[model samples]
Target: MMISSWRRRRAARRAGKEPRRNENGEMELTIPRDFRCPISLDLMKDPVTLSTGITYDRESIEKWIEAGNFTCPLTNQVLRSLEPIPNHTIRKRIQDWCVENRSFGIERIPTPRVPVSSTEVLEILSKIDVAFKKEDGEGCRELVVKVKSLAKESERNKRCIVTNGAGSVLSEAFQAFSKASFDVNVAVLEEILSALTIMFPLDGEAKGFLGSVSAMHCLKWFLSSGDLSRRRNAVLVLKELGQEKMDELSEMEGAIEALFKLIKDPICPTATKASLTVIYYMITSTSTNEQLIAEFVNLGIVSLLLETLVDSERGLCEKALGVLDGICNSEEGRQMACNNALSMPVLVKKILRVSNLATELSLSILWKLCKNEKSEDGGVLVEALQVGAFQKLLLLLQLGCVDKTKEKVSELLKLLNLHRNKVECVDPMDFKDLKRSF
Candidate 1:
């Protein structure tokens, strides 16, 4: 039996599944008695009991039902009822055991938050509507906190609320505040924005519904002036709602500045990511809009993005470079990027430092600048030479980059050597190092 168990664990590891371990750092491959699902022979994540009193993991039994099976897996006896009650007691026991055995590499399972019921959601919505109608600022703020809590409970609750018309309700409430002739409490409005944050993973109809509201203009207000958490969630909502209305957002005063503010000084990592995502979608959809590109340049997006690249997370760096790649296609964007003091080294460093996506974007930005030599500064070639870009490019060529990136590097190298005399900033030792390395 030990030999069979060892073989089972060996096969499991070879197949890329993690085998359980003991406190002694050896594989403790034996399955716990109660933790195992009879149908799947795996530890149960969400256990449930059948009408016949047989228990199985929810996913496995659900699959069994989906496959048209009506009998209990253990008993093979027909179940009088198809609905399986969640065996919360067994699930808690499993969690407790995991906590006790955590030294064996067991992760304690977090208790799943219960999904919000449609009845409760409706009650909250009814209160919000009543609050809005009465022009009750404090009441609206109080009720919004409840809505926010429900949405934050779980992904399931988020989807449930949005599906049950919570998106439209939240949006209309914001519109009501914005259009009110009396003094609208900014705190109340911020709460409304917070509620939207919870409902942000909205469906297309929810997105479109939110997009139609005049409240989007409030993003410029909250993202620029609200607390940190509000700013983060505001941009997140923009990523979804702004998609349908990029042009409107671009035209809206302070909206563009608010976005740049987050990108430049990012309230948090998620805020930075949302800001990049917003810019990426904005540029990709309007690639040919010279006016939009000009706006991006005037807003100092290129220089700001380069500065943002210094130590950003890989995903943010990838997206920052991606936006730079698109915007650099414009003359104004190229000029701004090449003019920035830190642009060259940051771009060069990101070439191989970040992921393949970041590398591709960095190379593409370089290609665009190199292609546009008519600018008085002679494109990115001048900046690249000033930054000792040859050293990195040579290493890239020797070490290897993607085929397209390699081609861009090769073309960039020739430009560097061709413009060598014009490069007042080139280090003589760099050439000696280049020659010796070659």
Candidate 2:
């Protein structure tokens, strides 16, 4: 208790200005304005000065440059180079202040590492190329690990590694390994893939190699590999491939099944989301292909989608519903959805609960099911009401939706209302009509 009192008194003395007490009777320490980064408005740990004479945290400025803006964030001056010089003076001052304020829980920031350069990344890539040519598996692995280490150091390092053509080099190495009948050590293959994962949103040159048949083989193998991280990276790469190359994915044998397997037995949250995105792409791309849609239905994708919707959070829920909506574009998909007992309940539960897009998707899928209400049982309509779909629809209307969504909601209400009276109701007692048995 005495030590605490001493620390408080010390803090008060160090307060350049008069320290003010808060409602809780604790002194509020103010950070100096110059110690804060202009862009982030937080205490600058690694301050760097731009050519415009404005200083910012290195991470913040690097992100700004990575976003493709070459001008100074504060002064709007055009940048001749993206690099920023470290403001050693400000950093040292901040460190000293942090040391003096240790009793107040402020931590001294460590000196920042020298930022990696594209030239350094290129040199490493060149060494990797030499290692590959010599079929030196161990040498290749070590170099790839080094590159991965650099990529993990900072976002700037990653951009440097990517722009210097690391992706293309690593991709070519993977192809070479695969073409050699897997002659390269598995360790080498793993390291190459690890390095490539760090260089994400693969550049056009890298993507060209990945789109090849050999790269497809490599991806398929990794998707089924025992390593969960490898599986995650494989799906992420596939997601990055986008809808344009979905045809290649469809053509790859068991590729669709393998993706479904990933969803069924998720490797991780990121991997699961990626797999769902890939499936959504595939479904949309094959919208008109009845055979393919039928294949998806046969694989029980509709039931799986409904299952996924039950416990998913907003983003994953949105993607799952999107895939289901595309699946409903086919007759078989609609029948399967209606046949599943969980479909209406899950879809109804998501309404107005997740996000605008999710509500829209649930409504779209429900509309597809109810659009053909003339079926033998009218079960879809009856079941929708049974699941309290009527009340949710009414609430959604009251909440106000877009014109497109409002139209669907109106049509759904109309269809559901038709089956309203058809729902079994309890007989209310009428005293006048009641006959007493005495």
Candidate 3:
């Protein structure tokens, strides 16, 4: 009986070692379960064992931890430490398997570079501070460039840099450099801003420093810089600084004009939205400041805004409408808006057609245009009726909007009703006549 059992065990081991093949007769190698990261469920490239004894790919685990979870992904075990230990044994096995199965089209996973540690980030920040304090522009430039590279490397590196006081240090350097002669320190300042941009959502201390007069000065300079990337970074940082400082931000030389330029010719979607957001905040902050609104109009904001409302996506259209609402408070803005052939028609078309916010803002602009005695030429109201505003407004009221919006819609209905005889209220289904009018 013992001899028979031994023979059976030997045969089972041999069977396990035999090459696997499908009906097509091609060799197949099933990856061992241990070779896969528990988190990604794929073959581990840079397997690192957690404190919970489970292993995961470095990239996947880092992202998981960055999202604020501190437990192991598989076991749900509380982690003793966030740092993952390298599982060299499993990695070596994976690499060997790749080599053995090279004929099966399996490629080896290249070893990943070590993630930048918080200590290393802090050291770099220290060097940046030293160079900045010494006024060593060349050294500071080099250090900031290194920091920027690390920031771009991975999200892990960004969190590490932000975890240390990199933002505060960089903001300090930016403010200090901005106070100096522009020609001498522009290069270093640009590098610092680039690094700062990567590690965004500036910490509280960083936000305070960047919101200062000097930092705003530096940002204003970058807004008009020839480098598109720097301009984008500057606008993003300006957004992070918030609108509490809009009074100061609007006063910066060429700041509003540069922002208008960015809106006119967007750098990227994010930058364009940031520019629009900043403009929205400025307008909201000074809702009663007619002079500022007219200044924005003089910058050709009205025509640009109308173009945006006509062509932009929903979010951009909403923001554009918000700014337009603020501007139309003044006689000059309402006049420009009414003068443009597309203004009243576009405003009427946007009602009930876009988001609730868009609907509200569009209605607000129309209300301002139609209700203001200074600009109520009846012609604007006639144009709105021609574009089917009456039916859309009725639909908006029935669908129910916020109380404020409901009030505006009702008032708009009343105003449009007054001009019922001038133009027909066409339904959306009445396409032939609508097309003919166009």
Q: Pick the candidate with the highest TM-score.
A: 3
> Tens digits of per-residue lDDT for model 3 on 262-362?
99998998898889888878877853467678788998999998887887788888878888888887889899888889888888878766776887888
Ten-residue stretch with the least lDDT total in model 1: 429-438
lDDT: the better of candidates 1 and 3:
3
Superposed by TM-score, candidate 1 places the C-alpha of residue 95 at a distance from the truth, in angstroms, of 11
RMSD after Cα superposition, model 2: 8.2
- What is the alpha-carbon lDDT of model 3 when measured against the actual structure? 0.82
Which pairs of residues collide in model 2? none
Runs in model 2 with CA error above 4 Å? 1-43, 49-56, 60-81, 87-97, 133-135, 183-185, 395-407, 424-438
lDDT of 1 by residue, 193-241 (tens): 7788766566666565456546666765676764788788778888877
TM-score of every candidate: 0.69, 0.80, 0.87
TM-score of 2: 0.80
* Error in Å for residue 84 of model 3: 0.6
Worst 10 residues of 2 by lDDT: 429-438
Model 2, range 1-438, lDDT digits (tens) per residue? 999988886665455223456799997666777888888889898999998888899988888887899999888999977789999999999999888777777899999998888778888889888888788888988989998888888877777888888889998787666666564466787778777877776877778777788777778788877788888888888888788778777767788788888888887888889998998888788534576678889998998888888888888999899989988988899999988999888888788778889989999999999986577557888888877788777777777878999899999999888888877522222112322222
Name the regions of candidate 1 deviating beyond 4 angstroms.
1-47, 50-52, 56-115, 122-141, 154-165, 185-188, 281-299, 374-417, 420-438
